[model samples]
Target: MKRIARVILLLLLVAGLWLALKPTLGNRRLTFLPQHWSEYLDYMDFWLNLGAFAILGLTVWFALGALEKVLQRLCLMIGSITLMNLFLEAMQSSIPGRAMDRADIWAGLLGCILGIATGLAFQLFAVRKKSRTTSPQVLFLDQTGRLGGAELMLLDIAAARAADSEVALFQDGEFRTALENAHVKTHVFKLGEEASAVDKQAGVASALASIPAILDLVLQIARAARAFDVVYANTAKSLIIGGPAARLAGRRLIFHLHDIIADGHFSSLNQKALIFCANYCARKVIANSEATKAAFIASGGRADLCVVVPNGFQIPEERTSTAKTSALRSSLGIQPAAWTVLMAGRLSHWKGQHVLLEALKSVPTAHAILLGDALFTDEDRLYAQRLHTQAEEPELKGRIHFAGFQSDTMPYFDMADAVVHASVFPEPFGRVIVEGMLAGKPVIASRAGGAAEIIQHEQTGLLVDPGNADELAAALLRLQTDTAFSSTLARQARQAAQDTYALDAVQEKIESVIRHIAGSNKSQLLSPAIPLPKPPPCAA
Candidate 1:
């Protein structure tokens, strides 16, 4: 038809102009072809280039249509063109007989920029055409009546504080109070009476009895997800409760994995449940370490679906406690002359406080202070009771002091000679070791899990075999008796902590990962969302 012929004619004319102008538009050899022809063509080239871009502009405008969502498209186009310019410049510098043409590069960049601006303008116009919509929301969920590691993480995150974070606790108790104190938005669900509760309301018994309460919690998550673009679950119980709700609300689900497993923390039955839900129910699992990521894969969870983002810290400008040094020492009833050894964590068996007590039998001149106690789930209260009994032993009596639980540990950290983490099990990420190092204190941690990853042997701090009393005693004696060696370790420890675990460096890595994920998401949206092709199977 006539329309087809006219389209062909337009295409031919455009091709002719490009072919005629190619040599002049490229390289610094502007006059190589023919002087007169070059002058004439160069002038024409400017307008032709403009026209080409105008056509490109029009094509982009048409492609976006009435939707008018232009910035993303503009960013895509401009970013692609900029990368190409870099490549061309590198080629010109490397290739023989080809000099870098600054003007041509600028022209190309200008054309790309103008094209992108025009696309954005069209998109802005489209936005004017669309109706108003609400901003997206975020939902956070945690189980247990106590505020411990996960609760502290959420509180610190909120206090920083990010926008659009809402926290809900599975059972209400002390954690609710702490959440309130932090000025964080929180909801507490009463699973049962105090007596029948798990750790007074933290258990499967309470969770099962509160079927109606669970349904309500599900409804809240569903509502929140509908309002938000994504629903992020901060606990395993939340994934059990919030994952289905998010799916029902047509929202994405993200799981934050704080716990690391090797073979036997959870029963096989529970592990199977975690693996199934992590693989099929959630869009992504954010693990705190590479070890955690590998564990997920080994446990039959999707390897590709896991992301590793280390937990970040905000180094306080000042230590948490302001009491005079003498007062802090006096509060623990320590004589001015005693060498104080401080341990700051819940006084539980797994924390290896009992082992520390036994280790103290060998390091006589040192007075040890156990700072934290009976925090988190009361499920460990019996273990704490045993620790209390061990501490009260006639011979061990006056040497050790149990300072129940203090919100601020910095004052104690300031007063102590050294900080120690003697965990029997591998911690996913031990903040205490990092915290101690940041305080410029010499640290001794068990050689286990993320602790091993963070501390360099004989450099940052000393690492002893976990649950070994004699090894811990030896490390204690070395720091206590050898002042120069302790000073050397302390100096190196602070430097490493600042260099590696400093807030900004960790944040930069997190930002890089997030930007990469965001870019990947955009790419997926641009391409047809055909199911990702199955990867080839490994040979037996």
Candidate 2:
């Protein structure tokens, strides 16, 4: 109901903004006179307008108990007004017979500023006049210092300042800067300057090394847990370490799963370890996608504890430049005649870069640009070296190029006619495929994981059988040869991407889940662990 109200309010705001600014927009630029401003101002109008919204906003705020919950109350107020202003900006774009004016946008900005100021003014006045308390906060954990997907989501959460949220990460990673930029308080776990002796050890040695430090870290986190309403574990290591501590502290723990384990990308032991940790420690598990949630349940996880939350994205401006694409191709040493097939991700076997190579052998692409660098485990570094060697093999030489890791893959995506995600194993979520779609490029992905759920073969994008070189090759060939069919697919893919992965839609779903959990009294809301119903042993 609250979510619906919020959406309705935003829609009204958009409508109001459209009404107010309709006189200001067109293909032609125009200026307005400020001298007549006083003529338009009426004393009664000021009182009536301010009073109307103030009353409405306060009613909502008070009903939502914002008076008692400081941060959340502030979030509600800010989010409401921010959406209002954003809608107003959007309204500045002409709507048929509607009038559009830049002045109205300026007015909307003024209104937002006044609203926020009014809110702060009221808060300050109330505090000065009386005493008030704030609710406990939720600590959002992100151990990965880099501003990757986990960090990006954490940044958005921080920006929302939703439900007394705060962020914590490793001391050295780039996430601290991102959090700081978002005006989110940053707390470092400070697990020393480097991974402890135990963290550096692999297999048994590494497991032993991580145990004590992790346990100690858990205790420390448990102590700090007093300040938070809940401790959210955003990374695998944190889930393993922080879950027990949160439980010990009698606090709720949320373990967010961003990756799928049984995807054979991780070693057998690594997969088992992740499941074991999740099963034993997490009070609740938040899977980034329904596919991940299903995978977890299949591996003896508690279904009741699992919550499906798909990934979100902010659509980037479409960049068009034939010259830029040509430049990118030139820099990569590709001939204009060669068709450049692209695959992007952190270079890893689990990511299925090798699958792309195996498929490449069956296809007749002019060249392929493999983008990304070794990340997380070094298990795939040697595999990458071997892939390079394979690329140099008699038939494949000069046909495959290692482009290394690129922060901005837009140029690469633009250079390629189609983007491929040939993951032999299921991906927890295939962000690249969506990104490719958003870039208005057709995609071919493995029929597993999130890709299976998002792509409709021949409609939005192509899906090939996982680990099947022949199918992937055929899909690639069809895309390369059939421009009309490919364009249709790209168009549909873009629409689907916009509809499903757009920031606002994705954020709405995420916020709804967070609001639901925050409203609950239990620190941990475990999903029921139900056994998977058997399918009659494959009818053998």
Candidate 3:
């Protein structure tokens, strides 16, 4: 119905424009037109102009893809149509038998205002209909509100489902701001005291110490879940806290598993606890990659409830211009002759910034940029400081640059000759690998968990053994020395990323999983799951 309405509006717009411009194309007498300004209000041409411009304004409003706010869309339509009317009126004076009339412009302006008002009414009606029928109420829960890979992924999910979803954050930070900017309603739960960072290394005792705070958070989530049809746990901590809360509210729980629940990534205690919560509290579990799913099952998670659904990425709308890229590189003090490499992620020990620095020693001509900051705990901060100290060593001295915590990593990606991922431990999903591929850069990633799943060895990209600086250095040097091979790898990687990891594809899969859970009865939801067909290849 909306498409048909838009088509009709477009046809009307074309006819109106043609009618308004017809007289200006030829030498036509304007004797029928008003002789005075007061007479313009009574003239047929005045009404025609008003109707034409009104249609034009409505067309513009309907053609808009997505606007964050209704008022912003209305303003855009009114301003655009007003300027177009003024230009048309100005052109009348230059035409053979046409006279520029201020009254005509006023009529058009009035029409534009009316059109915007009409558009607002239509929007309100559509929103109401959507709320009543189409839009499902979803509650998204995340433990941390900070911007990390998982947090970024959660932002994308919330943005895609913003029409019917509300987000609940355990702690408030930049991620909450991102969700709000995307027009998703966000609520932040405050613990009475600062909560400890949730990490496997923190041990079960450390987590137990925050029991009071966790209980308070669980209560808040349960209350919020009651208003929503489905509760989505977007991270590890969220699964632990939101799982039981969802059960309490009698809401379907879908846990998005973005971690590898194995000894390499999580301690045995943390892994067992996560599996227990998922099996007992969650109706379904969506893993970010096959590796993540396998790890979860190996840790004794219920395989019947789990399915693999990889992270989606978007190709950059426009490639960075050469001039802008040069300017950025110059600002960063990168030498023009130097081959630049970028490693982007939070500066955690397992993420491998330190490993990248060690590898850089073998590639003397290549300059390295570390584009992230330590997040969460003081331990991460100290680890970052140690990396800084490591970069100061004689081998890496002038070649390594720590470009701390970039909110936007695209500029660095644009400036780099290649991108590297060198995690010492297994990753649940490596978002940076796909991002680099989307940017059309050759990626060299560790050959351990999800990164291995993303890069097809020498096919899509080069994969080195995790924690092996020698192999990483070799891959880097190969790219630097072999331009043709590098370009071929980049092209293939980009194609793979676009084909499998596009945002819409992943969102569709996730929505299907949620809908399945939401539609099922408690008995059906917990029954033995049939084996899911393998997902199409993706960067995860």
Candidate 4:
């Protein structure tokens, strides 16, 4: 479709050039379409030129297709087209009987605007068509193909509903392949690198630029969403586009919020937009933790729109034997007597790998194994390098192990004396904390946000002030020396995991939310969600 649009745009540009630069037959100045009411009105020629320019605008706008990567390509395409039109007008001055006209420029610009509006109206109309498929109860939307925490969770959700659901992703990666491996019907609709690159730091201009691509993807998803009873967005980006698509398709929208919508994590513009979409569009907002829910409420998000749902985790009935865990410990070459601290997560600044390295300096007897790697970007890779430099220091030499990213973290977890989550920021939901507990190890997580919600100080696990290496060091020492206490904490933590974050209960709760809203009528056009709009007065 985009290829064909580009061809039409090229031909329109050629026709525009001919109209502006073609010599007049009489060799006198040609003013076929008079702009003023005073001059003899050439209504026929006037309408003809206006129609031509309007078609030009439509083709240009369509050629730009979703204006992906507004920062670079969007600016380039628009600037190039503007320069082309201006150059053609300039060339008309060189013609024997023609001259560049400012009135023409103004008319062309207006035509372009009208063309873009028409294209948008068409897309909006396309969404109003109701879905006919009713067998698939849900449609899951995710923006990235990478297996982040959210993708991992979605894998479980989609897999459970593989018989009656489909996953639509914006990019292609292991996440898609994994879904296919799990027998979950998956489709990839590439949203281009330009659109995906617009991150939380992106300003209003960048977002405005990405709208073309956002809308394009939304239209595609909305069309597909018509077949399903519900639309589920697993990431913030997905929610931004999916929310509108679901509403347009007359389907119930559910936003599975994985990030805490805050200035610290997202730009102010993003925070407002997310809260707006959730409040006005979605039937339910499934927050991973109460901390996530609190942050949502604090950020102008409606309090009643959110429902806290912890990511479900379950311990295996047949646990790895002690011998296997000991073997993993021996492979790392640290002495068996050395206290081991295990932290598993992507190696990023906020994930606190650096702080954990600093804390190790205060606990001389401890050895640390850092699992997970910088999954994306050069910044994280540099962070990993700095960590290596920290490990090479005399006091920390031969103690810190960089295990990198592991497909399976169970053996590493089994070998650990304690699992530490040292994120500098408040985590939305500490997957590592529950993971450690499921592995039957004591957990010490930063005491804020969702991590704080998971651990009771000195009970199931310990919590320290975020980013404080000294406090973290103290917690490590306490866990290392107090074997009996650590064992108790691990046992209590395991119980806590089984009761609250058990996989069965977590999936069941989420499925229940889906079941409740899946029956909503899909024939009706878009309408404002509850709490955002007051209910109509009841008939007595």
Candidate 5:
């Protein structure tokens, strides 16, 4: 179907271009040239040229298909069409009865702009039609609008499902902007205003205070849930609020477990409450890693209701030139010969930005770049300040650089010799570990939680004890000194990442789970569990 459409568009473009330029081509000679813009406007030939260019522009726009960026699409359409029309008009000046005029160029530009607008409108209408006819309607509920690891993962999932899904954010923040940029339909529940302000440290008291607000938000979600086939809860807070709402609306609920809901990260009471919600309300539980699923089950979540689905990433196209990498290093004042190690995540203590800093002291020749900032909580802010103070210490000065939060970290990944994951606590899923692997960088990750699941020790990548600076430092030195060993690991890791964590494969698995629950009868929703697939050999 797509090939046919492209062929038709190509034919139209060819015909339009021929008709628009015919007057200035072949045996035509220069005569009766229009000296003024008014003279060009009076000629009926001007409108024919303008209409031909408009058709040409519209055909070009349709041929481009659905581009991820609207601005880039518009620029390509308008700029290319306008330049082509202007060049053709200039050519017309040398031909008889084919006079060049500024008015003709302006008319063509206006027509191209109108054509682009028309193409965009048609594209939107087609999207709506496809959503209604082919795809399942999904309502995604997320707790915070902050762009944390889970939120970033959610954005990827939402982007994959955007053709038929609507995302509801509990509170407004940067994640909302990201969703909008991805062209995903998003809604912010204003009732979550008070709930969003509550501090993470407030514990049980915070939960108690947010109940009324949560209930109000639940009512809003329940009403919205009626229109969707699946209610996907992307966070613990969302599962708590949206699970009941999904139940109220008689819709299938899928809980996306992104964290280790254990006593370390959550209080005992909170852990129990989370388990209760998952076991009782949610029809299916999608754990980001096997480790997360194990933790959830250990905390009394129903094993039958859970399935492990690791996060996936798209391997970015490799840079053909080293110019951009060199520019990035120079801008950061990093020595060209220095061994650069990168650690990317929010600058929270548990994320272990300080731990990475401490390890850098042992590897004096290596420079470290921390690629994220404190995005949520007062504790995270203080933690970031402490990391800065620690980095300023005599031993660490000039060796460690804080690059802060970057929306695009791929360039930094390319600049690094090795990527490190130094989380003090067990991470639910270390996205950076796989990302570095995909970039073909030797990843030295913590030998705990999901990081362990990603790296196959010395075979694929190196793993060290969590929070142990000495072990991390030793691993870094080993990679720097042992050139052949590091290259082998990086090569294997890259291949493993491509085989297991490609976005298309993972999204299909997730979509299947959603469709299964959505299609199941109400009585069978919780009774028959989707059997957990065996973990990948590298993960095992």
Candidate 6:
């Protein structure tokens, strides 16, 4: 019915625009009105303009995409619709019987306001009319629909709880398609420029200035969250909106801390803001790594609120298919006997794609397949271009496969002999490292932060110093040179990953935390923390 109404309104808009632009009909008949209807009013044209444009504005509103329903977009549409009508009104100057009238312009403006109000009221009423019993049990909030480490982890968690939870993304991208592909319910509640302008590096003034946009998003999320038992924020940006929304909705909030909230990762002001929100709003903070948890506490976040939980990576069993692996290798131009190393992460300076390229300089004949794309910022895009240039250089030419972003990296993983984690800085929790382990490939991870905590030195996987190309190169050389040791490392890492980071086990641990927090009613100060499962004992 709504679709039919929208179509009729659109057709009415086109007809009305056509009639308004056409020359005035000379007394044959413009209306089927009791021909005496205009006898009662002197401003019949003004009323016609009002009614026509009101319907026109409503039509425009309904025509907008769901993500474009924010105030910024609405205002743009309203302004455009008004200007179009005014232009038609001005074109009246060219007609003999019609002249531009200020009254007609005023009527159009009034009609647009009415239409905007009606549309917004109808949307709000729809939400308010929904019963709490019918709402999703869990409302998961995420900052972006770009598949970063945090987002990938969130996808796994949300997919596991698809029957009871729904994810709300701040922006739209491939993440939505991933969710749909995984059979998980998802929605996009887009944030406009103001919300985006205030990033992790934003100062206090920038944050203060974005309050209006923040508050608006909060209200919307709060209204929708009233039915959910828990409001789970999947990223730092999500916390900015989810914290206040959860408070308003009177629901327990879970902050899944994916970042190391320290000097390099965030501005001092943003660090303070994150601490303030987590302390005040979150019932429980689920930190991805001990480094992340420690950083949160060091930056003034409450220690009692945080609990460390590793990211549960859902590895497809089919990634182990040797036939598919060989096909991928053939497609990517890896020689049958070439030693290929796989590095997967977004293209950013801190992620050290440059370091990997430099390391490849030392390991001359080794081929590297770089997965992931520049998902955010102009800087990253620039870096990506530079990488392409670097890849073309003499020592590295054709040896590096710049295989941009791959939705399912499993095939790429299957094609590689070893997986590398090359972040220049401390990773909060190395999702790719665990993924490498699960894929049954030898991994050489940066020896800092969660990567240090996950690998049991040379027993399970090799660890290299962060940003050291020589160390990375040497590890690459050793993995290629000593095939038996590499196979042993891969076997042990796979066993450890299977025992500790299995989907069902990790999901149940997190669900326990969620249930404990949600059922507490603020009675208990903290829920029992889920300890990292013991790594399987390794061979000598």
In candidate 6, where is summed lDDT lowest over 10 consecutive residues?
531-540
User: Which stretches in model 3 have alpha-carbon errors above 4 Å?
Assistant: 1-132, 192-194, 521-540
In angstroms, the error of model 3 at 199 is 2.5
Candidate 2 local lDDT, 144-257, one digit each (tens):
676566666667756766447777665456668767777778788866533432221235556755666677777888888756656888877677667777666655677888
lDDT of 5: 0.81
Q: Clashing residue pairs in candidate 5, if any?
A: 29-95, 29-96, 30-95, 30-96, 31-96
Checking candidate 1 for backbone clashes, the offending pairs are: 68-123, 197-200, 197-201, 198-201, 198-202, 198-203
For model 1, residues 414-461, the per-residue Cα lDDT tens digits are: 788898999998777777888888887899999987788878888889
The global C-alpha lDDT for each of the candidates, from Candidate 1 onward, is 0.67, 0.68, 0.80, 0.81, 0.81, 0.82
Identify the runs in model 4 with alpha carbons over 4 angstroms from their true place.
1-136, 522-540
Which wins on TM-score, candidate 5 or candidate 6? Answer: 5
Per-candidate clashes come to: 6, 14, 1, 3, 5, 0
lDDT of 6: 0.82
Root-mean-square deviation (CA) per prediction: 16.7, 21.6, 20.3, 13.6, 20.5, 15.4
Over the stretch 1-540, how does candidate 3's per-residue lDDT look in tens digits? 458658877787676565455553223333355456424533577787777667666665666622233455566677777787778768767766567789888989988787656665676566456545765678998888789888888788889889889999888888899899999999988754434365765576777787888888888889888777789999888888898898777677999999988766677667777888888788789999998999878777778889999998756689888888898888888888789999998898889888889888999889998898888778789999999899899988888888887777788888899999999998888999999999999999999889998989888999988899999999999999999999999999999989989988898888888777765622232232333344222212
lDDT of prediction 1 = 0.67
Whichever of 1 and 6 has more TM-score, that candidate is 6
Q: Between prediction 1 and prediction 3, which has the larger lDDT?
A: 3
Worst 10 residues of 4 by lDDT: 522-531
